[model samples]
Target: MTKPNILHESPSQTAGPYVHIGCAPNFVGIQMYGGKDLASNMLDPETSGERITLTGTITDGDGKLVLDGLVEIWQADANGVYPSAADTSGTADPHFTGFGRCPTNLDTGIYQFQTIKPGQTKMRDGRAQAPHITMWIVARGINIGLQTRVYFPDESANATDPLLQSVPEDRRHTLIAHKLDDQTYQFNIVLQGDEETVFLDI
Candidate 1:
C-alpha cells in the first residue's frame, strides 16, 4: 500500500484532564478564577416558578459511573422565555438564569442541578414544544460533548412535541426524566449501549 504524500487532518480529541480545571475549578477544590465555577447553581430564592432538583450519574457503555464528567444545561425560564436578546415572544423572568453547569462528584460520579421546571416553548415551525431541559455532556474518551434533552414525563405538552415525535416510540423513554418526588427528578445518561439515551446533533 502507498502512503499519502501530504498530511491529512488530525483526529478529534477527548475531554481528558483539562475539562475539570478549565470548566469546574471549584468542584475539584482548586479555585483559581474568581466568582463561582460554571454550573455551580442555576438560581437563587428570587427565581420564580416550581423549584426542581435533578440528580444523575454519567455511565459509559460498560455502565461504569464517570466521576469526571461535566454537564451543562440550558433552558427557558418558568414562563418559557429564553435569556437571549433575540427572544421577542415576551419578557423572561428577570431573576432566573436559564443556564447551568455542574461536574459529577469525584467519589460517586453523581451530578446535581437546582432550577425551576422550564415552561413549554414554541418551535420554529410554530408548534409548542414540550417542557424540556437541554443538556450537554463532556467526559474522558468523548471527543465531542454529546447533546440530549430531558423532558418531564408528566407534562401534558409532551404528546405533540416535534422533537419527541421524531424519535422512535421504543427509545423515547430515554429522554424523559423520572419523577423522584414533587421537586426532584432522576435522569441518568448512558453513553452507548442498547439502552443508550437519545443524543441529538444540535
Candidate 2:
C-alpha cells in the first residue's frame, strides 16, 4: 500500500503533520510511569518476573538505525487491564505489571523486549476493542518527545476500532505491524517519512 503524505496539512495536499523530525538528548535520569499495569507478578526463581530484554532498532527516514534514541513501552498483561484506580489507587495491578523502559545500546537502533504480547484494550467509545502497545520515543536532536501506539496487523478488530478509525484512512496503515516471526514483531516508527506513525494529542 502507498504511504500517506502528512507534511501537507491541506485537504488537497493529503499529508499529515511530519513526525520524528530532529532528535533529543540521552537523558539518563528521566523516568516516568505509564497508565496501564502489565507487569508479571509471578516471580521466577531465576529472576524477577519483569522482562528486560525487549529489544528493537529505531530507524531513521532513510531506514537507518537511530542508535542514540530512547524508547519506553507500557502495557497490561495478556488480560488487557491497566494499572488504574478501579484496581488500586496510586498503585498498579499485582498481576498486571505496569511499566518498562529501555535505552538503545551502541547499535544506534536495536531494542529488545522480554515481555509477553499485550492483550486487547477497551475502546475509548466503549463499543469496540483495540490491540496495541504504547511507546514514548525520544531521539538526540528532537526537543519534544513523541507519543504513539504500535498496533498489530493481525488484529482484524482494528478495522472497526474507534481510535484507529479516528485517523484518516490514508494514515491508518502507520499503526499496522510488520510481523518478524511468530514470537516477534517489528514496527518501525517514522518522525517524518512517507507514512508517519499516528500521534495523539493526549
Candidate 3:
C-alpha cells in the first residue's frame, strides 16, 4: 500500500528571549515604529473616562519574577462598548482603542498600562458581566501564552458576573485587581503554587 502523505504538526515553542525584540522592538532600544512600542499607550487626551493605571508582576512557580514577560490587555470603553468593528452597537468611544501592551520592566519585573476603567459589559447569553480587562501573558518558559481577566475589586456587578461566579469562591480572589488608589490598581499574577491566578482556557 502507498504510504499516506502525512504532514506532521509542528511542536509548540515557548516565547523565547527575542520576544521583546519582535513584539516591542523599542523595548530593546531598536528604535522602530516611531520609537514607541505598539499599544504602549491606550489613551489620548480626548479619550473619555476616568484614567487609571494598572501595574503587575508575573511570578513563576518558584516565586521568582519573570523579568522578560510581556502582558497585553483588552477592555471595553468606559461606556461599556468595545472599540472593534465587531461591536455593532456603534457607540464605542472613537478615541479609545480598548487595547494596550507592556513588557515587564527588566529591573522591577513589573508591567504597567495607562487606560480607562472599563464599564460593565454583557455576556453572550445576555448576562451582565462586571467591568474587567482581559489579559494575555507570555514569557520565556511559557510554552503557550496564559490568558486571564482582571476584575476590579468593589464592583457591585461582580456578584452577578457569569464568568466571575463560575470560578470557585476560594479562587475568585485570584481574578481581582486590588485597588491601590483612586487611579491605580495592582494585579500580580502567580503562574503556579497556591496562589496561581485563575486562567481561562479561552
Candidate 4:
C-alpha cells in the first residue's frame, strides 16, 4: 500500500519590529550586514517615467496607525512593461526597477514610496489591465502580510478595470488613492472594521 503523503503546515509568525532590523538594517542604525538593503529605492535619477510619491498610513479598526508596519510595492514601467526577464511583451524601461519598499515612520505611522507612475499592463486573458501598484503590508500583530492594490481615482481606466469591477461598487473606493497633488498620492490601508482594505488571495 502506498503511504499517504500528508504534509504538516508550518506555523505562521507575525512580522514584528525586528522586520525592520532584518530587512532594513541601515535605517535602524545597524550597519555592515550586506549590500544596499533589500529595497532602499525604486529607481535611480536616470529612470524614465513621471516620478511620483505615494504616502499613506496603515491603521487599525479604531483609526490608530501601526507605526512599525512595513510596505512593499510592485508595478510596471511607464510603458506598461515589467522589468523582469520573463516579461515577453516588450522591453521595460532600462532605468526602472519596478519594485520599492518602505517602513512606516515610528512617530507618524506613515510610509512613503517614491517611484514612477505605473502604466497599464496586460492580464492573462490578453486584456489591457489598469495602471496600478500592488502592495504588501506587514506589521507586529499581522500573522500574515496583507496584500492590496492601489488605483488612482483620476484614472479613466478605473471605470472598466476587471478587478475593480469584480469588487462590490460601494467597497471599491477603499482601494483608490486620493490625489494630494500633481505628484503625490495618499492611499491608506485599513486592517479591520468597516473600512478594511480589500486584500487579495495572492
Question: Best by lDDT, which number?
Answer: 3
Once fitted onto the true fold, the runs of candidate 4 whose alpha carbons sit more than 4 angstroms away are 1-11, 33-35
Q: Can you give the TM-score per candidate against the true fold?
A: 0.91, 0.66, 0.93, 0.92
lDDT of 4 by residue, 1-202 (tens): 4457966667678889778888777778787466467777888888989989999999999889899999999999999999898888899888888988888988999999889999898788987778999999999989988999999877898888999989998799999999999999999999999999999985
How would the candidate models be sorted by TM-score, starting from the highest? 3, 4, 1, 2
- Regions of candidate 3 where Cα sits further than 4 Å from its true position: 1-12
Top TM-score model: 3
Model 4 TM-score, 2 decimals = 0.92
User: What ranges in model 2 sit over 4 Å off?
Assistant: 1-55, 86-96
Model 4, residue 110: distance off in Å is 0.9
CA shift at 194, candidate 3, in angstroms?
0.2
Clashes of each: 1, 36, 0, 0
Model 3 agreement with the true structure over 84-198: per-residue lDDT tens digits? 9887755899899999999999889999999999988887878899999999999998998899999998899999999999999999999999999999999999999999999
Tens-digit per-residue lDDT, 64-124, candidate 1? 9998898999999998999889899889898888999988888898989999999989988
Lowest lDDT 10-residue stretch of candidate 3: 1-10
Deviation in Å, model 1, residue 73 alpha carbon: 0.4
